[model samples]
Target: MKFYKHAANGFKIVLERKITMHTTEETVVSFRRVSKIFNKKIMALQNFDLEVKDGEFISFLGPSGCGKSTALRMVAGLEKASEGEVQVFNEQPKEVISNTNDVAFVFQDANLLPWRNVLDNVVLPLELRGENKQESRDKAIDVLEKVGLKGHLKSYPRQLSGGMKMRVSIARALAAKPKMLLMDEPFGALDEMTRQTLQMDLLHIWEREKTTILFVTHNVYEAALLSSRIAVMTAGPGRLSALIDVDLPRPRELSIRTSNEFMKYVETASNHLENGSIGRELG
Candidate 1:
């Protein structure tokens, strides 16, 4: 899928989706008027319409109750949309999810088994899919190296640091080679330094694999740092309030956070975040 390319000297945002982009921009995930309510009164989301085109990195950014995580869960087929349709691969969420290697989710906690070593944990998805053990193990080994955990294949969850475990979690998610990856604040629990490292690592994986990523996070800076676009939501009946394009040049280094252009992007996202809208439609 193609993104609206931006010029460096401008602050304006324009998304020109052509008729041809419809063919080229394959939608990996979509939510149409989707709402989630708990206890039949607590409204987590209302009329949320979002479409993730193939290979796009979009982050859902909002306050705690604005349903960012809820949206992400819908994509993973873990939570049904209470009011509308949620699709993955142009089919119902569960339909696509029932098939192996279509979608993968990375949660906040690295839920790697304390007993399984890194190799086994990463290969678990394949094992469940009935893939040959030797082949899955070989694939998992290569993927782990890409995640910088090749050296820790024998280490258990308890034996590794927080970031290493998260890397393993990512490696596991990538094992099945899912077309779309849903992440719910996967690095939220880590320290700033560790989180930053994972952020860069994730970008590398995304670029190399061309996986469609729908990331849910509250950290504005993190969202700005990683996404092609950031969807800002409003509460009191959650809805998409803004879709802010990240126009920064990629192969992005951490030091780019200090640039004037980067600061401007942060300011724009922060403004939309604080006010909840910037005249952008949910479409």
Candidate 2:
């Protein structure tokens, strides 16, 4: 394959001739010197700066306690930044949190209600929003089908496998049809085979829905496979260490993991991750 290079924000970017990932100049999320402190004692993030473009899939790859989840929570309006600013859709996250159509979050756990069936769990968000009953049910069914859970609509959380439960959780998020999905290790708990399957499923859903995604993953391979860019963070008092652009061709298959190009991307990300951790220790 042919290759070309370009520069943006002082960083070099390389792309393959067949690269198909699409992101616009329009900024969807921005963090300017943002920081997060818990109880005024512990600092989770410091001087974190990032810009997420429209339709981009970005992953946070860092060691544990690097505040990846904290950053995501701030984007979700579940946590407030102690310093600087965080903007989602060009507005303060707090300003848009009330608008259900703007953001959706999928956690590591399915967090499904045991008493509710699959369809009911998926429909719950719309219900809480006081949306029309029939429309909500229809949307739920549609998203459930998208996640390959149509036939299991009546199944309870207890009856499904770990992967299936996560699918239901994702379906619940997608049913809202949000403009962006904030996923915090949504597939980290599953087995390797199941994680690969769901990773493919997620890519398909992302391509079809055209939804921007902010994913957090500890797995370098997963980050390289799923992200348009991977943000490597330093250990505690987490900050941006490197923002590695993943220029892999889109519609990626599992087999791509073994490709030289993909391995190179993984190596780059892994190096950044290790350096970031070491830098924190030295500081």
Candidate 3:
């Protein structure tokens, strides 16, 4: 167990040890004084700093334009910081992403192939990596089953529900057996009932796989339900406003979300975003 502190403007940050059994005690993602700008005028991020520990689940909780996705992109090497640095496994994001098997990024939408079956979609990454067709098929089947899509491997994207498609997306990510998973509001589009259901399913997947996850979501309850720590950010030149430790017991069931203790953590995180971003954004 280790305590890591990050100093940044307008907020104090402390990364509590994740209560998970991890093989390594290394930092998975580190953002050092990172800033990102677009078109030289729009500032997507400003002096952002975060440290993601191994096997930890982190949620970037903020508004729609708070650079939550931008931060996630930086980790995946989809976007680069204008200043400072973002290191994945203490290596460049380009290096990690180039390896293909080191990281997987899941977007807001399922982004599944309409023409392909569920198993085919999940095996696409492995095929791209030049694995044997039969071997890839086996890996895809295993991941789909792990994600509760065992009976639907032959189903196409159009045949599945909103939640099911997202499940396929996750299954695809897992098929490659990546070391880290980066999710940007993967369940944000689902209906409330579906969202809650998937949240619980996702928690189960996280526990079973034990991969490092950097999830970006604005929902207070979702962050509280899923993350070990929530990094609250302010909008318009987004920056870390607070890093709140959840400190809740894990192997958690969806029932925990209804508990008073759970709501208390939700309220605390909600207040931090409220005081840091919502309160000022309205002005």
Q: For each candidate, what is the lDDT?
A: 0.82, 0.86, 0.84
Q: Is candidate 1 or candidate 2 better by lDDT?
A: 2
Per-residue lDDT of 115 in model 2: 99
Question: Where does model 1 exceed 4 Å of error?
Answer: 1-10, 13-23, 278-283
Worst 10 residues of 1 by lDDT: 14-23
Report the C-alpha lDDT of model 3 over 108-155, residue by residue, as the tens digit: 899999999999999998998899999999999998888889999889
TM-score versus the correct structure, for each prediction = 0.91, 0.91, 0.91
Ranking by lDDT: 2, 3, 1
Task: Say which candidate scores most in lDDT.
Answer: 2
Clashes of each: 0, 0, 0
Clashing pairs in 1: none
Residue-level lDDT tens digits of model 1 in 1-283 = 4233232445544332322211247777778888899889999999887777788888898888888888888888889888999988888888888875889999998899988999999999899989999999999999999998888999999999999999999999998888888889999999999999999999888878888888999888899899888888886477877766777787788998999988888887676678644233322
By TM-score, how accurate is candidate 3? 0.91
Clashing pairs in 2: none
